[model samples]
Target: MSLRRWGAVLAGAALVAGAAVTPALAADPVAPKVTVAPATGLDPAGTKIVVKGTGFDPAANDGKGFGLRVGPAKADVRDRAGKDFQVSRLIKKGAVGSQIPLDDNGNWEYSVTVKAEYVASGTTYSAKKQPFSVFVFGWDTPVLTWDSTTPLKFTEAGDAATGLAWGLRHSWRNYVTRGGGTVTPSNGATLDTAAPNVEPYPYKWKYESSGEGTVSYTGQVTYTFEAHTIWDFTIADPRITFGGDGAGTLTAKVGYAFYGTKTAPEKVRTPSDVVLADLKLKAPAQAGDNVAVDIESAKLTAAGAAAFADFYKPGEALDTGRLVFPGKSGPAPTSSTVPTSSAPPTTTTSSSAPCVLTPDSVKQGNLLWGFKQSFRRYVGIGSGTSITASDGVEITDIDKIDGTGPPSGAYLWGFDSVQYKSATEFTTQFRGKVTFAYPAHSFELSIGRPKVVVAQGKGKLFADVELKTTSGAPSPPISQPGVELASLDLAAAKTTEGAGALSVAGIKVTLGNAEAFAKFYKVGEVLDEATVSLGASCAHLPGPGASGPGAGPGVSDDLVPDVKYRPDSALASTGADSGMWLLWGLVLVGAGLALVLVVRRRPAPGQRP
Candidate 1:
């Protein structure tokens, strides 16, 4: 549908009698071409939907162009109001904000308001209520040869109401008014004062229950009709209720009078609290007890029809109107949460102090890896990638790692979860997550809880890996639990033993799974090597990384722990080459031992005297 919005209406657009021409029936597929958008989800918000037409009869209807209208579904050429006097619109030049003049080619573009006025049909309520449609026909003579129809869908999806107004039934009210009868709202039923007086349900009433869905109103109206004493009837005190789930009822008091049928006296009866209509709520409000809405699709009940002397049949359409309800308020979810207490935990010393070092003992050290350099470059820290580490994990000394990884950076993840099965076999697991996020591409890779297992003289590195990427891109999202990421070649690895300590350094790292990269890298790729340094006090043994009574030379520590010597803390921070650091620490150790011996030998001053 070509539904383009038109801004300004043609100025001084006038409707005049046109030159006459004999009309001929338009044939099939020979109708005027027209288009409109959104044949559904319509409302009365004054929003205009533009309609454009071509090939309409310019010579028909005395050259005044065909009439444009919106009435019912199918927009039948034979019926203008489409079987019900409910709602329709006739397009007249500058008439009630609907106007568009046709050019000589029988083509024109116009805008029509979404709202439609219900035209009273007869003594009955509307026969057709839903699926309103749009149509085009002759203004005077009906030449329906050229035709196009579009069904409109209306919705009040998110609408709410607190107060309501309804005229009960459109045709009944019109019939009563034509017969000089009266309809009054006396008990709390008020008028809008500004709304059109012909509105069916003009009496406004306040909602009594705002229980979200189930609601009631606080007013009533009376319909009084007495036509020449024929059959005087009064339906009064009408009430409406919504059950929230599209089912409800309407109750009212009724009074009927059968003025003597030529032989019998007048028969008068009053029935109180009669079920007037069985309401079928149309498009009820969404869930929650915040606001009430319209009670739609109301129909006459059997008792109601009987009370009306069968003039109207049971299960017929009744007027359903909106009720403007106020929003309800209450305590929010967060405010009702329980509070937590604050305290500290107590720590107890292990009874097995000065213990022997074992392979099962927990150790402390760090591991380094660069991940992948190309992918890191694609999603740098600020551009598209953000990396975070958490869970008792501290990653520092980022630049120390060598080889392909993050640009100008690699990482060291310090782990305290270290255990050993034997002196030569040990396993160490990391504590935290390093998440690389690429928001622009909707891709993320998180590698966490890395565990390195060394057996005999060989080892492997594994970690929990979660990868998310578009399937349209390099790879699909996946969660690989305990993925073997790299193989550790410990052949050149150096394990140093100290006072109850063990340090394994310089283990080569080779890619074990290219899939861990989300297909960004391939297999057989070399990554940064790693080191493990740990120390713990044991039963009858000094912990690792300890210099016991000047007994040995230094160890490797470009701060990495190396075989033969363990460097002092001060020398470890120098960033010296690993081999050089090991050699220097040994020199310092020898010097320290000489000093200790000299001091011990010179301490016999009392014996010399």
Candidate 2:
């Protein structure tokens, strides 16, 4: 073979190898496979990020490596938009992107700061923005993330660093400033109510203090809004502090209903002094111990006063008048005296003073009394005529009478308006006109005589008497056939002043037409007898040098009566009735003896003796 032929063959073989190698080299340099450590991060500022790449021309441009851009877009490097989007740096196989200094408000789509670029053979070659893990700087700490694409979730501490980069790009605009406090992002606090019926999303940020100090703090955060009409509701108090920690929680609470498009009011006015939340800070206490301020007891303006007034009427005073607090334990003082029944009179009566029972110095009032009677009468008129009567006597007013003046025999008059039932009228013959005149310890009850003819009929009747007090045991029935009237003698126990008990004793019923009545009531009939207790007292009345009636010494105008009724041994044995029963027994015995004698005289042991 010729030398030229060998060389041509070798050159042909070399051309084939070179052709295959050229296609491999010309094909798009496999975009530098890049990965970013810590794919996502908290916004505003976070930990450092590392970029790693493979299959990149390490010797491109004399070992200058790939040119990396850590920004929003590749065009951002060309047009020098602010430093945030125009970050450019040189990266090697495992180089780190420059510390991207972001503003307090972080960026969302800041591409993985590793773009491969090389200048080869007088031609510049650059790879498009490579698909690398994202490093998102967000405004929140990523504790909870909610957006249209990402389901709301609370990130656990262990998984917070993993693929947490999602729809965190949109700007959370500020809605309102309230509570006279400062929020992070400098007024960037907003309420997102875009989702229908969903709670407004809150932006998490640090709250700082303002001009308002802690003392007059009303840590109430309320949101005033209107869906159809203006309404106000509470959210949370950001000013809550615990153990003097400034890094306290800002709890978000749902307030009023959402504003619908059609239901929204024409003009939704923003409240001037509306507080969205309270800003709390830890402070030292006077006792050298840390204590959180009580939010409930703190004086705070009602955030939604107008809204509250719609439900509850305003300006009405609450009734707290009858409330009483128990007194603390303590010993009774020597000067404090206890009331006793045997206590001596505080006033002494002079010897020269008359022993008369002055009406002015006695307690008196309307009293009611009652007694029962049974007798017979013939009706003079077909039906009895009813009449009312009053004791023809009058006494000075108890308040005007003076104890030192002349004793007034004026009776405390009692009047009865008698209503005659048909049965009662026929039986008593309309003789029920009763009246009472009461002096200190005694009383006179008078029943006017009936204007009817007597007859041998029998019936029961009640004589309605007006007694001083009704506080006593009731009397038993007075059922003597001949008895026409009954009497009760009242005696009051002695007391220096004030009301006391009165004893009703010495009960006696007078018999009318005893001789004719004895035919039916055999000299003795079982008469119902009873003892009644009267709640009466000798109360001192208004007089010269005397405190008002019923008032103890050093007391005045205490005219309340303390009448007490107690019954004992209700009725005395009916002595006259017992004697009547004994006489009947003798008569019955005599008759029985006469019957036995007649039987004995007739026969004895079947033989005539």
Q: Estimate TM-scores for all models.
A: 0.30, 0.16
What is candidate 1's local distance difference test score?
Answer: 0.50
Q: Residues 236-338, candidate 1, lDDT per residue (tens digit)?
A: 5555554544566777777766656523537666656788888765543431323334555678899888877787899888766554444432221111211
Question: Per-residue lDDT of 545-590 in model 2, one digit per residue for the tens?
Answer: 1222233221211111111111223322222331231111111254
lDDT values for all models: 0.50, 0.24
Give lDDT: candidate 1, residue 481.
Answer: 82
Candidate topping TM-score: 1
Give me the overall lDDT of model 2. 0.24
Q: In order, what is each prediction's RMSD in angstroms?
A: 33.6, 45.9
Q: In model 2, where is the ten-residue run with the lowest total lDDT?
A: 318-327
